[model samples]
Target: MSDLPILIAGGGIGGLATAIGLAQKGVASLVLEKASRLGEIGAGIQLGPNAFHAFDTLGVGDAARAMAVYIDSLRLMDALSGEEITRIPLDEGFRTRFGNPYAVVHRGDLHGVFLKACEAHPLVSLRTASEVLDYDQDGETVTATLASGERLRGRGLIGADGLWSNIRKRVVGDGAPRVSGHTTYRSVIPVEDMPEDLRWNAATLWAGPKCHIVHYPLSGWKLFNLVVTYHNDAPEPVAGMPVTHDEVRQGFEHVSPVARQVIERGQDWKLWVLCDRDPVMDWTDGRVALLGDAAHPMLQYFAQGACMAMEDAVCLSAELAGAGDDLEPALRRYAARRRLRTARVQLQSREIGQHIYHPAGAHAALRNAIMQAKSPEDWYDAVDWLYGSTGLEGAVSREARTLGPE
Candidate 1:
């Protein structure tokens, strides 16, 4: 094994998972995070079976499962009538078919699981308050300059730095991400605080014209995570901005009474101006590569942003593990393997936001009808390509026999 480390920028889920994946392969990594401590600021995340497969590969499946709520089904309802349009059952048969169960978890809890695993690994070195300001890479190695005026050398570099990544500027040269003309308000409250009638233990989505609301139980059903999104143009893109409960209610005034009832239950709502970049052909330059949002930022409509990033970590480590002394080829292979899949997700997410989640008048009716016609098995088949397995050797896929989505 190489004595040098694979330096990673950003200590979020993607960066830490990359370090853990590398460590499992007897490779070392150094993760630099800008925050004083490692944590996630979001409320909840819905992880499909694919994420659990990645967790199993990273050796943290049990820990992650212990903190998550395994949902019974995913229900999509009409926000106006609050009627169930369709549901994808995640029951025993569904779990058997997918090889893993669907789960919803608090983002912070999931982050902690990855963080602890990385910290316990001897090959992984985590540094907080150490941001990557810039980098210079040659044929053999890459040097990362930190915000503290310190420089670190590594065999290669992975820019897991997220959407507004500094490394993305130097590598892809893409400017700021484009705003989606959508604003999302999110909050978490005690499950007991919600109306007794509204307390359901499944992942449910209420879809209306130009807006939608998604909520599910998290933290072992002790809390409920609610997110409401609508088409509202902000002056500029921002995240985690505080907004009043009234502001959130006003956005959904036209929604059904049931929807309003749920939206009004939360006190504090944080606003986020959603943004993403167009898919690009290159996510790698020489020995430095981009991962997660830095490579392909997508809207939350698909709920695969973090899932894809975790997949990238697994794939990157798998390719690099067998590349011998040549790191660039491995990085190129990783990018090639992920480019099409991530691009599909990026484009599909945008399309789903418009066609499926935000349709109007006749289009909305047609969407609901079409979804209603599909059987639960059909829904499972629709995502078979996504929730399958990666089947990589000497990595998470080492023990698997099939390759699934990215």
Candidate 2:
């Protein structure tokens, strides 16, 4: 089995997590990254219970917890007035019920844990600066061409390359991803710089018409991560360009003063044109499968993009390892199990973005009413299913049998 390694494209969170999961399952694989170094650009993400459980399964949940800030509660407020409408406790009770706390961490820090795991494992090898150009799959082998003119042959190829996946082009025909008609501005600020009185150990969301802002501490309370998204007639910023302060302010002219304060704090920011694809029909073709953003690119609304990818890595690895000699069918069954769950996340992320972030007219009022009607715990219940999943038992029992002799 080692003769034909599993080739993973894109070494972001999903790819590395997949590698780690494969290692834990005794399935060896190689991860190919387009960047020269392994790093992620983004602020903190909320790891709901489901992701937290997967993190524990990957054996990094504790390390991640050490680096993350635990949200004691979640708050929903009037976007324009700053009046707290509802609050949900995310502390001991929340953890006890969900089996994991709502933890937040910078994207890079989380990625670091996964990278360390990969490097320490003797079974996992990583090739950086190796961009996948093309791939071909046969009955027993899959081959990928690198930009440097090198070739890698493996039993299966998994693409975790992210939203603009090159591998997706090979498997699914290219027509650009659908834009959500929303623009997101992200920035990280030192926690100390914010007003002391307002500093709270909570994940807070101020929702307004056509825009919303989420803020929480990251890196053990040293820094705060902030993301603001708004529906706009303004053209989405070009990908990979610096977003100026003026651009951010322009999006939230009519928002609350506190919202403006938060935006102003992030004078320098990066912007992304929020786009998502229809849930992919298939993540595997022969021995080649797609994982994470390559398979599904989610908006930040659910904060499940990384979590889903992490779960995907674990399931893929577990199935492959349990399959023992039958790697091909194992890969197929892995895809079937993961594809449905990820597709739901993909579609659900966009739905949250649409309904929660960019609500219009009466829809905005309904969003506000819902916030007023529910406590933070009520909101927690809404997201319970997502953060509560641990794929180990189900994937092992069902997929293992699916890959067994017919």
Identify the candidate with maximal lDDT: 1
lDDT of every model, 2 decimals = 0.87, 0.78
Q: Judged by TM-score, which candidate is best?
A: 1
The runs of at least 3 residues in candidate 1 whose Cα sits more than 4 Å from the true structure, single-residue gaps closed, are 391-406
Model 2 clashing residue pairs (backbone): 49-387, 50-387, 50-388, 87-376, 88-376
- TM-scores, all candidates, are 0.95, 0.92
Residue-level lDDT tens digits of model 1 in 193-216: 887877777888888888899989
lDDT of 2 by residue, 321-371 (tens): 866556678767777777766666777777777776667578877877876
